[model samples]
Target: MLTIDNVSLKGINRPRLSNVGLSLDSGKLIGLIGPNGAGKSSLLKAIAGVEAASGKLLWNRQSLSAMNDNERANTLSYMAQDDTPQWDLTIEDIIDIGLLKKRLSRSERQRRVETTSETLNLSEFTGHSIQRLSRGELQRVLLARALVSEPELLLCDEPTNALDIYHQLNVLQLLKKQSEQGRLVMMAIHDIPQAAEYCDELVLLDKGRLVCHGQPFEVLTKENLAATFGIHADWICNKRGVAWQPRPL
Candidate 1:
């Protein structure tokens, strides 16, 4: 399990995460959802140990603070919201970088990269420079890089931001599959309906505070949506299912 207790960032005047806590187990996909500046990215960074945050983070009974850089790298993989490659490396090379910390035979590393590339539809562009790819392509490549690492805990920030509708669904399905394979996959996402459809759980944050969290049906209440997103849509539940359409203010 991944446990976070009283997690708060210190550098800022106010707490970026407040005294927040969460305990998540493997084989689960958690989606972090909120408006802009809601600390979604900050929370993801804290969980990835990339930001300076005061918290007790434990993964499978091991304290995160006690783990070395390599140890952390071996256990978790983080995908930044802005993952543009500066050096114009090839798709294969960027994917291979995910395994740099791992001790693997050259053939095994190649195998992993190739398999991940195929999974993300990057096989055809394996030798192409990242600079030559479009934004959506780059996003897929970056995700492939993160997925290739095979981390026990995967933290991704707005991973499907630049992708089209099809790719967005594909990525969400992939994350769901990863969790089903006994890995913990948490992503910061903005697409509420997609999150509602796919995530096992949803964590809603606002202004660095954890607003609400639970199953989609329980947490996405009309009042909660109004307070959190100013969404005054009519929420109707029928024999078919629940559905909501936004209304103009």
Candidate 2:
């Protein structure tokens, strides 16, 4: 389990995240949702140790801060909002980098790279330079790199930002599978309907404060939605199930 206790981050004179706390268990997909300036990215950054914060973030009873760089990287894999590769490395080469510390043979490394590339439908572009790929293609390649490491905890911020609807569902389904296989998957998402469909738990934030944390139905109420987003939604349920259709503010 991942436990966040009384975590807070102050920016200049403003508080970006204040007294935030939440616990995430394996086999659960958590969705972090909020309006602009809600500090969703800040919270993920704090958990990934990319930013400093007060209080504690513990993984499986161990202090995250105490872990060395390699230890933390081995257990946690984070995918930033923008995953475009900086250099002109080939897709295969970038994927191979994910296996940095592994003592695999040449054949093993090649096989892993091939498998990951195929999983993300990057086989055709495996030999091409990452810089030559489209925005969505680059996103998938980066996600493949993260998956190749096989970390126990996966944290993604707006992973489906550049992908089309089909790829968006594909990525979310993959994350769901990971969580079901006893890995913790936490994602910051703007798509509320996708969150309702894929996430097992939801954490709603407003201006750096935690507004609600619980099941999807409980946290995605009409009142809560209005309060957080300042928009009215007509929530409906049919044979296909629950969905929220937004109305004019």
Candidate 3:
């Protein structure tokens, strides 16, 4: 389990995150949902140990702040909201960067890269330069980078921002699969209905505070929707899982 205790970040004029606490478990896909400045990115950065915050981010009772760079890299993988490649490297080259910290042989590294590439359906573009790929394709490559390492905890910030509908669903299903395989997956997602459908738990944030965290049916209520998102929404459960419909207020 990951325990976040009183996690707060000081902003220029206000707190980016304020006394946020959550205990997230493995084997579940959790969605962090909120408006534009809801502190979703800040919280993910804090938990990833990239942004310093005043609180304890403990994984399995171990404090993340105390872990060294290598240890932290091995323990968790972080995918930023927007990552622009500095070098126009090949897809395989970029994916292989995730394995740099591991003590794997050349053959093992190649095998892992091949496996991850196939998983993300990027095998055909393995030799292609990432600079030439579309935004959606680049998103998949970044996600593949975060997944090739196979860390215990995965933190993704808006992993599907630039993807088409098919790729968005594909990525969410892959994240769900990762959680089902005993990895803790927490992603900042913008699609409310997708979050309601795929995530086992939802963390609702508004104005830098955690509004609620629970199952989708429990957290995405009509009241919460109106309060946080400033809209009227409803959810229904049927054969296709939870479906959310939004109505203008």
Candidate 4:
């Protein structure tokens, strides 16, 4: 289980996060939902142990701040929002960067690299330089990097921002499957309907403060929508999934 207690971070113009607390466990897909500067990224970084902040971030009852770089890397995988490597690294080579260097055996490392590539449908492009791939493809490769690490906790920022409709759905479905297999995943996302459908819980943030958190049906109310985002949306739900269709301008 992961426990967050009164976490806070200082930002450039204002405070990034303030007094945020939550508890999460395995086999759950959690969505961090907020506006552009809602401290979503900072919160993710703090949880991943990349950002220093007040309060406590604990995983399995252990303090995250106490872990070293290597220990944190093995415990959680973080995919930043602007995740693009400038080097002309091939898909497979880029993936190998996420492996736990000292822990995995040579064979185990190779297996993980291959498996992650295939899972993200990048096997055919293994040898292609990341610079040669389109934006959507590169995003997939980045996600592959996070998955290759096989960390117990996966934290991603705006993972669907670069994808087409099909790939967006594909990636979220894959994450759902990962959660079912008894791991934990937390993703920063803008799409409310999708988050409602796939996430076991939704955390709503507004200006560095947590407004509310609960199941999709409870958190995505019209009042919360207007309070968080200055717009109204029509709700849609069916066998396919839940979605909020914003009223046209």
Model 4, 72-181: lDDT tens digits are 88888888887779898899889999985548788988899999999988898979999899989999999999988878899999889889999899899999888888
Which candidate model has the greater lDDT, 2 or 3? 3
| Positional deviation of residue 59's Cα in model 2 after best superposition, in angstroms | 0.1
Q: Global lDDT of each model?
A: 0.87, 0.89, 0.93, 0.89
Residues 59-98 of candidate 1: C-alpha lDDT, one tens digit per residue: 9989987899889989999999977889968999998999
lDDT of 2 by residue, 1-249 (tens): 999999999987678999999888888999999998898999999999999999999999999999998898789888888956689899999888878866779999899899888888889885899889899999998888878878899999988989998989899999999999999999999999889889999999998999999999899988999999998997776678557889757
**Ordering by lDDT:** 3, 2, 4, 1
Residue-level lDDT tens digits of model 3 in 1-249: 999999999888889999999999999999999988999999999999888999899999999999998898899999998888889899999999999898899999999999999998898896899988999899999999999999999999999999998888889999999999999999999988889889999999998999999998888888888998888976677887666778778
List of clashing residue pairs for candidate 3: none
Error of 2 at 19 (Å): 0.9
**TM-score of each model, paired residue for residue:** 0.94, 0.95, 0.97, 0.95
Clashing pairs in 2: none
Model 3 clashing-pair count: 0
User: Of the candidates numbered 2 and 3, which has the greater TM-score value?
Assistant: 3
Which residue pairs in candidate 1 have backbone atoms (N, alpha carbon, C) closer than 3 angstroms, thus clashing?
none
Q: Which is better, 1 or 3, measured by TM-score? A: 3
Which candidate number has the best lDDT? 3
Those runs of model 1 whose alpha carbons end farther than 4 Å from true positions after fitting are 11-13, 235-243
Count residue pairs with overlapping backbones in model 2.
0
